[model samples]
Structure formats: structure tokens, C-alpha cells
Target: MTTIKGELLEGETETGMAAAAQGGQYGAAAERASEAKRALRLAVASSMVSKVCSIGLQAVSIPLFARVLDTDDFSAMMVYFGVTAWLSLVAIGIWPTVTSIAADDRRRGQLAGVLTVSWVGLSAIFASLIVLVLVLRPVLEQSGINLFSARHYSLFTAALVCYAMLTVLSVGEAVNQGQHRQHVNNLITAAGSILNVVFILLVTYFRPPGEEHVDVTLLFVASQAGFILIRVVNMIGVVVRAGWPHAFPGKAFARELARNSWSLLQAQLAVVFLQQGAVLLCYETDMPRDAALLALLFRANLLLHSFVYMINQPLWPIIHRNMLAGDWQWVIRIYRKLATCYVAYGLLAIIGAAFVGGAAVSLWTAGEYPISNKLATLCAVYFALLVTSAASTPVLMGAKAFVSLGNIGMAEFLAAGVLCTILYFADAVSFPHVVEALIAANAMTALWMMPTQAIVRLSRGSLDAQH
Candidate 1:
């Protein structure tokens, strides 16, 4: 026993000095690595809970809104909502870039300034739109659309306010995302819905008792104002938390942000055209049935896709941090993992939507709106394919592979335009034609850029890690 002890002591002595120090260093590193992984797991769990909660909130909120608003009013409000949302992409294309820049140390202080510039720019555009809407008020009111009646002019103006408010809110969202505090955005969104409900009830209650039926236009505008109020409060909180750096727009800073954001905005425009342009096109072609179909499809898919975007909100900051840290290989590996997870989650959602969404939708609409399983199936398929881009594109964005992605986007836009034009000119256009266009466009883009180039690069391994 003594000899064994002696030998052990001798072995310890051999490994004790420099070897022991090296061993201790490795142990500390292992501990840090484990802690990081654990923290990541917690962040993911938090994100999932936030997403589920937000989606559940929307599910409940929509039905309640439907119950309150008459069909024509609800449809008109949605048109206002959808069109404003789709167009705001044009003005706030810099949000993703804001997030990317704010994720890093060098540009962290610049978020405030960038947001100021973006808000000013976007607000001006929205004001121009409001002026144009007012100028064309005569034409619109004569058009016989529910939103266009001279009586509903207040509602149209309110819708414009909603547009500007929502766009400005993106600045705060981008800040949260940059700091990996995306759950706060969800919390604010949930709060906004509550505020919306309260505002509607209050407006109804305060209306003169003789006029029990409050103007649908008033309800629409009030609810939008509620959203804006909540967003303003949240923005103040975020800025306070950030210690309110006076990021007054410096010339160079604005220019740099604009440069980085240009490609991002281009990407946004293309995506908006691909995903939400259906309704506009349908309306333009004078197909109200097709427009209605697109609206329902878009609303449902919007909720479903929210899960992906919610998860992605926390992911980009992590990627950006690593990119700045020069961890290229890690970024690729992370991208592949996230892409797989996103696609898998999307597939599960597709299956659920395809099999059951039609019946659920029919039940919700009381058979007044009987959507088919086949259409659900096709839309779900399109959604699943499209989600692959969420993780992929962010990786490209982090890698600053903007030029490559731009080329890819241009090709996709061209393909979509060609397909959609053909469909538009075709006799007796149907939802299937729209579905075909979506699937074809999504397939072309999703397959080529990240799934092909980025995934292959990851397989080959990261250049940074290799070097």
C-alpha cells in the first residue's frame, strides 16, 4: 500500500508543476464551455415559451375581433392592416441591419441614431402616403369599397397612423433583437393585444348610449392607437434600459447604416412581394374571390410563421456575435443545426395545418368560409419550404454575404414575376395558380442560396476555424 502511494505521489509530482497549470486551464475552459451551452439551452426554452404564448394570444384575439366587428368592416380593416404592413417593408428595410450592427460592440451605441434616421425617413414617407390618400379621397370614396366611404375617412387616416406607428416600433424590436432580448418584443406584442381589446371596449362604452352601435371605423382606429401607445411605452423602456445614448444622426453613421441596410431592404421587398403580394395582385386583377382567398390564407399563415420568426429573433444576435468574434466555422455549424430545426418544426406545422386547418377554419367561419383540405395542403407545403430561408438568410446576413444573397434574390424575384405574370394572363385563374407561383418561387430561392451554398460550405468546414 505504501509503495502504491509512493508511486502515485511520484506520478503526481511528474504531472504537478507546468502540467498541473495546463490541466487547470483546460478545466476552467471546460467549465466556461458548459456554462455557455447551458445558457443557450435556457434561452431556447424561454424563446419557445414566448412564441407559444404569443401565438395562443393571437388565436384567441382574432376570434374575439371577428365576433365584435361585422364581416365587411373586419375585411376592410384587414385590408388596411395588410396593405400598410406589406408596404412598411419599403421604409424600414434597415431593421435587420440595425439588429446586426447593434449585436456588436463597435456599433452598439449607434442603434439610437440609426433608429432616429430610419424613423424620420419612414415617417416622411407615411405622411406622403396620407396626403396622397386624402388627395385621392374623392376617387376612393366613390369606389364603393367599405374602407372608401367618405364616412370612413377618419378610419383611413387612422390606418395611416397605425402604419407609421408599427414601422417606428420596428426600431425598438431591432434593438431588443440585437441584445438577445427578443422575448421582450413578444411580451410587448402580447400587451399590445390586451391594450387593443381594452381600447375597443372603452370606445364602445363611452359612445353615447343612444348610439349603442359604435362606428366600426372608430373601433378600428382606436385599436390601432392602442397598439401605438403600447409600442411607445415599450420603446421608452428599452431606451431607458439602454441608458439612452444620444445617437443623434451623424452623417457617416447614417451613411454606413444605409449602405448595410440597402441589401437587406432589397431582400425585404422581394420577400414581401413573394409572400404578401398575392392579395394586391388579386385585387388588381379584379378578382374579389381570389383576394378574399388570399386574405384568409395570409392571416392563418401569418400566425403559423410567427413561430419561426420568434425563434429566429434570438438567433441572429448569436450569429452576429460569433461573426464579429471571427468564429466562421461555428457560424456555419450553427446555421445548419438551426436550419434543420426550423425545417423540422415547419414540417410539423405543415402537417397539422394540412390535415386539420381547413376544418378548423370552416368551423371558425361557421361554414360560411369553407376552405378545402387541398388548398390547406398546398399552402402548408409552401410555408414549410419558405421557412428554410429564415435560418439560412440570417447566416448569410451575419457573414455579410450580401452580394451573393442579392444575386439569389434577384433571380428569385424574376422567376416569381415570370410565373405570376403567366398566371395573371391565364384564363380562369384559381387559388391553385397562386399556390403554384408561391411553391415555385420559394423552391427556387430556398434550394439555391443557403441549402446549397451555405450548407455545402458548412460541410466543407469553416474557414476561420480552419485557419
Candidate 2:
């Protein structure tokens, strides 16, 4: 071996050169790894702050709207949004797939093209849903709950449009998640929630006085509409800045997205029904107020669930990466941690609802809609069930168990509807009774999730062994 002039001893030239080259590569890799970790830290921190603020704004929003509108109007408004949520689920087309694909696919520009098609195509679907809603108004009204009249039909239509438009932004956020830039999505969504506060204030100020019971509905819809517009624009700017310069591929990719997105649609609809079906069923009863209260109560429980979900959101990419690496131990450990954390959170939720929930409800409604302890307990139970079931989702998603998960979701939806049916024929038909039925139904679904998750883990391990 010969040495280069100024570098190494004469006999060790090849070894020294090889060692130096190896060291250089190692140093570069370590630097890149360090940078990647720093970025993840920042993303997580930014997401936490944004989620906290979003949760805060959203927490106050339900009760504040209750204060601004009369009981009947408030219920109607909640029902409108609740119904629109179901509609929104129909348009979720391929956004999540777009997120996962974005991580490894270097051609981010292709996704921009896909986003355009998804936006336009999904908008058409959403538009049709609005028409269907209009057409079905008579059907729903005939069912005994006259929730939305022609007076607010346009507002509901407009809100649905805003919601459809928002999916474009959601897909973009998914891209950011895949790209490890979650802070971008989290901050923008946080801004939208903050703007909601402004919209609420405007609705409060612009209301025509005594008719706040009804006219405030316009304000509620308007503020949400505005928030949707702003956030959509925010995401548009993010993509443009990313310079997605790839031209649109042929129709094949778009067709693929459309094909798979239908399953996503099913999954989303199942979730909405699982949570809101009870409330929707309540509308079919003489006590529309109970349906509305369940809706509001559902939203309130979202505040508690928000904590677990926002934290879980950041872990998706991390978990996805680990799963790709065949890190079974890490996956198992994290899943266990998630289950334990939710259990603790669930207990915290029950305590808060048991001790302070009634006082908080009274304060919010000013004795107008006094909540019973039983109702609060059932809501707490429902929430605990939500956490328990949802704990398995991220892991399933990491394992690419969507088809199974989607099937489970559909089964749960049918099961939940059955529970509502029982409520419909039950001897006692009060709100608490309705909620109790829902809690029982939701718990059964939650129980199924653990076994499914275990199956996924076992199947994965066996396959790995065979390979």
C-alpha cells in the first residue's frame, strides 16, 4: 500500500483512505440524522401549541353558541352541522392516501395535480349531496324532526360547500405530515379555529336582537364558512410554496385515488354514524331537544378527546417509519403506552364530569339546560369508549390494516344503529336513557378493537417469520 503525500503513512495508505472516507460518510449521516430529529422536535412543539389553542377556542365555542341562541335554535344549528359532518365524510377521497404516498414519492408535483382533480371532483360530489339534502329535507321532516327549514337551506348549502372546500386543505395537510412538516398544517388549522372566535363575536354583534334564537344560525354558519375559506387558502399557499412542479399524470393515478377513496369514505361515514347516529336518531323522537343535547354533549366530549388525538397525530409519522423498519418491539411498546395513557385520560375525564361537569353545564346554559349527573356519567362513559376504540387506530393504520379497520367501522355503525333502534322502542325515552343506550353500543365496538389489533400484530409477526 502506498500513502498519499500529506495524508497517511506509506504502508497504511489504502486503510487510511478507506477509514477517512468511512468517517466522512458517517459524519455526514450523523449530521443529517441530527437535523431530522431537530425538525421533528420543532414540528411536535409547534403542533402542541397549535392544538392547545385550537382546543381552547373549540372548547368555549359550543357553550358560547348555546348562550347566544335559544335552545331550539341551538339544537337546529348543531343538527345542521352534525348532518353536514356526515356529508363531509363522503368527500374525504384519497387525502389520507395522498399523505402516506407523499412520504416516499419524490414527485410531490404529481400530488398537486391529484389534489386539483380531487378538489374539483369532490366538490361536484359535495354539491350533489347538498341537492340530496334539499331533496331529503321532506323525508327527514316526515321522520318527525323538522330540523332545517327552507329558511336556512341556503346557509346549510353554503356551509357544506365550505366543508367540501376544506378537504382540499386536509389533503394538503396530509402531504405535510408525510413530508414531516406537520407544524404547517397544525398552525394553519389553529388559525382557522382562532378566526372562529372572531366569527362568533361577529355573529353575536350582528344578530337582530330578539330573533337571536333563529337569526344567530346565520352567524354560526357564516363564521364557520369564513374559517373554512381562510384555511383552504392557507394550504393552497403552502403547496404553491412547495413548488410541486410535476405535471399531471394521465387519468390512471386519478382513477386509482378515486377507487381507493371510496373505502375511506365508508370509514369516515362509519365514524360519523358511530358518534352521531344516536343524536340523529334522537331527532326522530318527539323530544328533538334530546337529540340536540346529545349533539352538543358530543361536541363537548370532543374537547376531552382532543388531548389524546392531537398527541396521537404527531406519532403517526413516527409510527409509520418504525413499522417500515420492522421495529416490532417499538410498535408494541407504543401501543401499550397509548392504551395506558387513554385509560388514565379516561379516568380523568370521568372525575371531571362527575365533580365539575354539572356546575360547568349550569354556568354555560344559565339553568336553561340543566344536566343531570346521570347524563354526565353516561357522556363520560361514551368518551371513555371512544378513547378505548380509537387507541388501536394508529397502529392499524401503521400496519396498513385499513381494509380490516374499515370493515370493523362499518360493522360498528350497524351495531350503533341497532342500539338506537332499541332506544326508539324502549319503555322510557328520556335523554339520559338515550345516552345510556349509546354508551352501551359504543362500548361493544370498543371491545372489538383490541382483539383486531392483536390479530394484526400476530399476523405481522408470523409473516415476518415466514419471510
What is the lDDT of every predicted structure here?
0.68, 0.67
Query: For residues 1-467, could you state the per-residue lDDT of candidate 1 as single tens digits?
Result: 99999999988888787698877756765564454355455556665665565555455545545656565555555556675655665654467667776677676677666766666777787778878987998889889755466765777777777777788766777877777677677667767666776776787668877763557777777666756887888777766766655857577766766665676556666666765566667755566556656777777777777766655556656766665554565566667688788879778877887789789777655454578777778878877777767778666666666656666766777788788888878764566688788789878775556567566545444654556
Q: How high is the lDDT of residue 459 in model 2?
A: 61
Clashes of each: 0, 0
TM-score of each: 0.81, 0.83
Cand. 1 TM to true fold: 0.81
Number of clashes in model 2? Answer: 0
Mark the regions of model 1 whose C-alpha exceeds 4 Å error after superposition.
1-46, 64-71, 109-112, 139-154, 200-214, 242-251, 456-461
After the best TM-score superposition of candidate 2, give how far the Cα of residue 231 lies from its true spot, in angstroms: 1.4
Best by lDDT: 1
